[model samples]
Target chain A: MIAELVLAMLFGLLLLGIHRKVIARIQRRPGPPVWQEILHAAKFSFKTTWVPATASGALFAGIVLVAVGIWTAAFFVMMTGGSLLIIFGIYMLHKIVEHAFGLSSGSPYGKFGGVRSVISAASEIPLFVSVAVIGLFTGSLELTEITAWEAVHGPLFFTAFPAVVAMYLVLLSKMPFGPFSIVESKELVSGYKTEHFGAWRAGLEVCNGLKTTVLLATFLLVFAGQLPVLWMVIGMILLTVSLSFACAVTPMLSPFDSVTIQSLVTALMLVYAGIVFTGVLP
Target chain B: MGSLGGIPLYVLEFGDELVYFSPYTITLFLLALTFTLLAIVSRPERQVDVAFGGDAYTTKIISVDEMRFRRFMAIACGLASMGAMVTGDVFNFTLFTAMVGITNVGIVAAVKSPHVQDAAYQYGLVALSATVPLFGAAALYAAATGSLSMIELAKGTLPAVPLVAKALLVIGVVGEGMAPFYAAKAEMFRAPGAPYVIMCSLSSLLIFLRVAEVVMIG
Candidate 1:
């Protein structure tokens, strides 16, 4: 599990680097190297991390630790074929971590970011629906069972494509450059991380990477099933390119617009779920 | 397990009339209890100060009477939530849910802001109205099974209760500010106190969780 987590972080950071490179190329600018995130983390680690005088000391100091811990647990659960219910629980807890990250800083920007996190709670339902859809087709909520089913019946992506779309949207909302990235947009002065600098910010960056890796890995696991190492890396790259393309083409939506889009996706998924539930869409 | 005063420490039974504690209830009970403790301990001192027509930076301290009342309400909310989770009787669950609603109002009632007070008033009305459906669901179950005990209901011996009754139970709990109803309580969070105010969210969440389990088991 520890090894998987460490590899997840490495791949996560690399994916982010790939995303930046792709976006920069599309925008006609020279971007940082694919290894830029590693360098960035190394630099931040050398700086002295300090809590701001105006911040809520305990909550402020605890956010990064909590974020890292939650994502690590998520990775562990996924790697071990543990309960998907537990993974869903971890995902919900991560929302609270975002709220805490913003609220703890006592900065207006952080507070707004925190409120945005709360507003974005609507996105959670679609993810839950996606889980239900997967459970329905696989006849189990355990990753082991789902993977075993896939081993016999093949990837669910062909049959459950709508759910795949919904889950992808959930992943998009969490990733940088996505429509929901407004929470940390430059206009908000980096939003929740406005106050957390140096090592703390680095911790958050690492957490972000881990979250990305977990989410993408989950998508692959459920939709594509288990693949050989070379094939998995190829799949990850293809996914990264597709997400980057979407990010490049789409403008950032207002929080209201983003929620509306998520709601529509959720509605579509629920309709699909109803069909499946009614035995009309075998 | 070990014994505490001649009663088993791990499981508690009271002839099935009062409450029963098993591994499931104990797990969720401890979860709610721990969050309540954390809510009390993690009280943030920065209070939101509202200004009517002038400077907003002027500092003001919460009055002792108001603080005492808010603390009392918060503790009451916590205890009521604990009761809702730990009780074996469906009627008692509904009763404690109603208390949770009342105390939710009490927790924010001390704030001297019109907007917040207005929201609290609205939430109170909605929450109070929820009791009809809540108690009605329990009553329907009792009528169907001749017993309101969840242990009995979970035995699967009685006729399956109507779906509407289950729907009523969920809707009543949702009135405690889950999802669509959350808009009514959103402004109440703007009240100055963080620790006491968090209890409002915590209690609602716990009740909703317990409702899910109860709905499933029963």
Candidate 2:
């Protein structure tokens, strides 16, 4: 399990590197190398670290561990094909981690970052909606059962298209440069992460990598059903690349606008869910 | 026994209520446990109000009186969340969820910041009103079917729970979670004490997750 987590962290960071690369190429700039993020994490870890005088001592430090810990458990949940509801729960909890990251340091910028994360709770609502829609179509909330249903029938990707779109928007919101990622917007000077530095930042980087892996791989596993490890990795890369292209072409929306768009997508998902509930989507 | 790992680890029955452990609920319960531990061990941070983006921090330490109150509320919130995650009866789940809501508001009540207080006040109103649907849904379930037990409801023997009752349950859970859930609720996080403040959000999200399973299973 440890080895798998380590590999997932490495691979997840590499995907992020690729995300940066894709974004840079699209903008016609020379971005850092694909291994830039790995080096970044290593570089941060070697630096001196300390809790800020004004920060909540234990929380300022402990949130990082919780940040990494939750995502690590999320990775195993996906790996073991646990209930999809557990994954949904963890995904919602990530927002709280962002809130804690921002508020723990008591930095003004961090507080606003945390506040923005809370206001953006609309983004995760569609996650549960998407989960419900999938359960509605497949008649089970178990990941294994959903995959089995897809094996018997074709992928829900064809039958329940809007759930896919909703999940994709969820991925975008969490992605680093995506329009919905107001929490880490540059104006807040790294946003929720502004107060965290050194080994703490490295811990966050590890969490981010695992998060990227679990979310993308979960999306693929759910929609595409079971696959060999290589196929799954390849699919994840493709999905990340596609997300990068979206991030590259678009400018970041204002925070309210970001929420507006996410809310709209959620509404659309609900409409789709309503249609499915009425027996119209089959 | 299966690849999809929601194996039930243990079941404890007390008189008429059952609290069981599955891989999923245990994960949530452990999270509440960890955060409660944090509340017990951590000191509240002094909030730095860089309202002008400069080095101006309020520097006023969170008071001892408030600290004890918040710690108490945080632990209560955590325990309520842990209960909401594991309860086997539908009405028991609703009661635990209501406790989570009250404790969520209580966690923020000691902030002493007018903004946080106002947000908590509004959230309390929503949470209090949410109980109508919450208990109402449970009553509906008991009326429609002869039992309020989730295990019994899941057996496909008694009359299936009405769709309206399930929808009402979801509505109630959404309101209970609305503290960290809505745009205005963000203001409550402005309260100091990240460790304790976090219990408010964590409890809401966990209960919401549990309800998703409740509606799905029962």
Give the DockQ (2 decimals) of all models.
Answer: 0.15, 0.62
Single out the weakest 10-residue window by summed lDDT for candidate 2 chain A. A119-128
Backbone clash pairs for candidate 1 read none
Cα lDDT tens digits, model 1, B102-166, are: 88888877787788788888887888888888888888878877877776776668777666787
List residue ranges in candidate 1 displaced over 4 A.
A39-42, A280-282, B1-37, B45-104, B135-162, B179-186, B195-218
**Would you list the C-alpha lDDT of every candidate in the order shown?**
0.70, 0.85
Give the TM-score, chain B only, in order for the candidates: 0.83, 0.93
Q: Runs in model 2 with CA error above 4 Å?
A: A280-282, B1-5, B51-55
Best by DockQ: 2
Give the distance in Å from residue B153's predicted Cα in candidate 2 to where it truly belongs: 1.1
Global fold similarity of model 1 (TM-score): 0.79
Model 1, position B28, has a per-residue lDDT of: 43
